[model samples]
Every structure is written in C-alpha cells, then in structure tokens.
Target: MSAKSTVDAKIAQGKRTVVFSKSYCPYCRRAKQLLKDANEDFDVYELDEFDEGADWQNALAEKTGQRTVPSIWIGGQFIGGCSDLEAHQRSGKLKQLLA
Candidate 1:
C-alpha cells in the first residue's frame, strides 16, 4: 500500500495523537519532548526513517495543507506543526485536546 493511503486509513480510524516527524529534526524532537513531558501518549511516523517517507510527506501536505514537521493531530484535530503546537501549549489549550 502507498504510504499516503496508510496514513489516510489511520486518520480515518481516529486521531489518537499522531505525529508525522523526522527523527533528526530538532523541532520534531522538541514537540515529542513536550508531549512526553505532558505525559501524552502518541504514535509517531518518523518520515526520515521510512522507505515511503516521500509519499507520506506529500500526502500529509496535500491533506493538511501544510508541509512541515512535527505535524500533530490530537483528538481528531490537526494541531499543525511544532511551533503551532507550542503556541497551544503556551496558551494552555493543549490539555483540552488531551482530554
């Protein structure tokens, strides 16, 4: 199956805290760290480590209208990339997604 379709299937099932990222990306690391610090459970798609990475990223951009990592989705809402998520954390809006 295509990486794009794989991602689509997962999303259709539920959000369940999914993040599209690159293992070597600092921003991705920062985002994951914040989630970890918050004790948040999430699944990760380390694009850089996947053979289908390019396909996945292309699909992610097409679907989310954004081409960046860490692309975060919590509770069925696409919370955007790393900085965007940080803004949510700063504004205390992150908990709402967790709950």
Candidate 2:
C-alpha cells in the first residue's frame, strides 16, 4: 500500500494514538514521554529509521499540513506537535481525548 494509504488506515483505526516521529528529535521524545507518563498506549513510526520514512512524512504533510516530526493523531483526529500536546494536557483535554 502507498504511504498515504497506510497513514489513512492507521488514523482510521480509532481509539489508538499514532505519532510519526524521528528518533533523534527532542520534540518527538517529549511528546512520547508525555503520552507514556499518562499511561497511554500509542504507536510510533520513527521516520528517520525507515526506508519509506520520507514518503510517510510527505504523506503526513499532505494530510495534516504540518511537516514537523511528532505529528500526532488521537482517535483519528489530528493533534498538533509537542507544544500542542502540552497545551492539551494542561487544559485536561488530552485526558478527555484519550478517554
């Protein structure tokens, strides 16, 4: 399947969180850590580690209009990067979304 298709399928899988990240990105680590601290189970696709990494990132950019790593989605909805996740957590929206 195409990278775009894979992205779509993963998002549509609902009730799960997905993060398209890069192993060396501090933002990615921060985002992931937040989720982990919350006891959230999520899937991580470390873009820098895979052959189709660029393709996946391109697909994600097209889908979400955001080209940064730690591109996150929860329950099929696009959630912004690390700072956004932090905001959500501060407002208690992250917990609501996870629930």
Candidate 3:
C-alpha cells in the first residue's frame, strides 16, 4: 500500500499520528503536549537522530513544503506546525479532525 494509505489506515484505527520533529524545538514539544493533553497517542521521529543529508530533508520538505520542525501529518493530510494546529483547535476544526 501507499504511504498515504497506510497513514489513513492507522488513523482510522484510532492510532496516534506521527510527527517529524527535532530536538530544541519548542513547537514540537508543544504539539506533542497538545496531543497528549487531548489524550491522543502519537509517535515522534527525531530528524536530528537521522542523517541530516539533503535527501532526507528534501523528502520531508516535499511532503510538508516547509523546512520547519514539528511537521505534522494526520490521516495522511499535511497539517502545518504548532501555530496552525492551534488555529485549528481554536476554530473547533481540530476536534472534528481528531474525531
């Protein structure tokens, strides 16, 4: 199956999503905390632990279209970093998305 399909299946199963993060990123920590506070389980992939080569970063950039840490994808949809998440939460869209 495609990666997107796999991600969708995981979300449908009520699994926590994945966040690509880096150390020293407050946004990443906050994003994680928000999920935890909402009682959502999520997995984090530390980009710092992986090779910082162009290929890996490029792949992420292509997916997110931004080089920012804490790039989040939910149900295979690209969700921007912390501020974007907060916006969704404030707008009540996040609850529906999580539901």
Candidate 4:
C-alpha cells in the first residue's frame, strides 16, 4: 500500500498508535506486518539513524520499560514487543484496544 494511505488509515482510526523501530530489525518488520494483517494502522518512528546513545534508548525504555525492537504503543499504552503483540492478537485483546 502507499505510505500516505497507511498513515491516513492510522489517523482515521482515532486511536493513538506509535511504533519505535530500527530498520534492520526483523521483529520490527514482523510487528508491522501483524498490524497490517489485522487491518490496523499506526505511526512509526525510525531510530535506525540514531547512534547507540543512552538518551535515545533510554527514552524508549522509559516509555516501554523494555529495550527491544518493535516497541509498540496503543492509545498511549505500552503493549510491548512483537511477541506480546502476537499474544494480544491471539487473546483478542488487540482488537479491543483498537476499538
């Protein structure tokens, strides 16, 4: 899909979603695909350009409380990494959050 369309869908959903990702991370790609498969949308913040500075990682860690790829926030709540997202999908809680 076009990037603009993906972004527009996310905005129209009216739920705050943000993904902090690194370009080379497989988990990040998986997380994005999961959301896409579910027909959900989200904003993504790339950290691939940043150096391994504590400030950058610490900010994410502060928000997520976990230093991992594909840190996802749903409506300002930390839903966790890729595995956690998949678990949420299995449990049907991810839909509830999106709703």
Candidate 5:
C-alpha cells in the first residue's frame, strides 16, 4: 500500500487511537504520557523508526496540514498534536472522544 493509503487505513480503523510520532520528540512523549494517564488505549507509530518515515510524515502533512510529529487521530478524526490534545483533555472532550 502507498504511504497515504496506509495512513488512511490506520485512521479508518478506529478501534483504538492512532498517533504518528517520532521516537525522540518531547511533544510526542508528552502526548503519549497524557493518553497513558487518561488510561486511553492507543496505537503509536514512531515514524522515526520506519524506513518510510518521511513518506508517512509527508502524507500526514498533506492530509492534516500539520508538519510536526505527534500527529494524533481519535475515532478516525484528526485530533492534532500535544497542545491540542492538552486542550481537549482540559475541556473534558478527550474523554468524550475516547468513548
């Protein structure tokens, strides 16, 4: 499958939250920790660990218009990055989304 297809497939399969992250990005780490603290089950793909990482990232950028790591999706909807997740959590929308 193409990178874009792979990303779309992952998002469409919303049995769990999806996070496209870089292994070493602090924001990625924090976003993951937030999910963990919320006891949310998530699938995290560390793009930095993949050979096609850049392709995936580029595909994500094209789809979401966000070029940074920790590109997150919940229930097939783009949830954005760490700060965005934080906002959702703060507003209790995260819990609603996880449901």
Candidate 6:
C-alpha cells in the first residue's frame, strides 16, 4: 500500500487526532508523551511496524512536506513534528487544539 491514496484514506478517516511516528525516535516518543501528559485523545501509527514504512514516510513527505517523525495532525490539520508540537505545548495552544 505505497499508494498516495492509502495515506490519504488514513488521514481522511476523521480521527480527531493522529500521530505518524516511529517507535524508536526520541522526538516521536516525546511528542506522544506530551500528548499523553495532556490527556489528549489521539492514535499513533508506528511507521516502523509497516514493511514499507520508509516508503510511506516518503509519500508523507510529498504530501505534507515533512520528512520527519512525529508528524502530527489535530482536527485534520498538519501541526508538524515533535519540536513544533512541543512549542505548541509550551504555548498552551496544544490544549486549545485538543479542545
């Protein structure tokens, strides 16, 4: 399922919050932890578990222009990677987004 449609379908399922991440990435871990600490409802897709995770990431890069782990979406908006999420966390905008 390396097709762009597959990724599009996953993103379009209307899951209020989603995290495209890798289990081994510290940034990804931090992003998840931050969301967890905030008690934010979200689903995480561990890209590393997929056989074509790298290719999927490439497709994602083409889609969102982010080639990094912890690609986050809230209310169907791409909020960017770990650092961006953390910035939002610190700014208290993360809570607002979750709400």
lDDT of each: 0.86, 0.93, 0.70, 0.73, 0.93, 0.86
lDDT, candidate 6, 1-99, per-residue tens:
555777676777847888889999999999999989998778788899988778778888998988888889888789999999999988989889998
Clashing pairs in 2: none
| Residue-wise C-alpha lDDT for candidate 4, range 1-99, written one tens digit per residue | 544344334434545777778878899999988988888877776667655433555566664568777778788677899999999999999899888
Candidate 4: give the clashing pairs: none
Residue 55, model 5: lDDT of: 96
CA RMSD of all predictions: 1.4, 1.2, 4.1, 7.5, 0.9, 1.4
In angstroms, the error of model 4 at 98 is 0.9
Weakest 10 consecutive residues of candidate 2 by summed lDDT: 6-15
Per-residue lDDT of model 5, residues 50-97, tens digit only: 899999999999999999989999988999999999999999999999
lDDT of 3 by residue, 1-99 (tens): 554444344444544466777777899889888877777667676667755423444566765678787877677677889998888888988887777
Model 1 lDDT vs. the true structure?
A: 0.86
Which wins on TM-score, candidate 4 or candidate 6? 6
- Give the C-alpha lDDT of model 4: 0.73
| TM-scores, all models, native as reference | 0.91, 0.95, 0.77, 0.75, 0.95, 0.91
Candidate 1 lDDT, 1-99, residue by residue in tens? 877788887666744898889999999999999999889988888999978887899899998899888888886678899998899899999987787
Model 1, 77: alpha-carbon shift in Å?
A: 1.5
Top of the candidates by TM-score: 5
What candidate 1 gets wrong by more than 4 Å, as runs, is none
Model 2 per-residue lDDT at 8: 90
RMSD of 5: 0.9
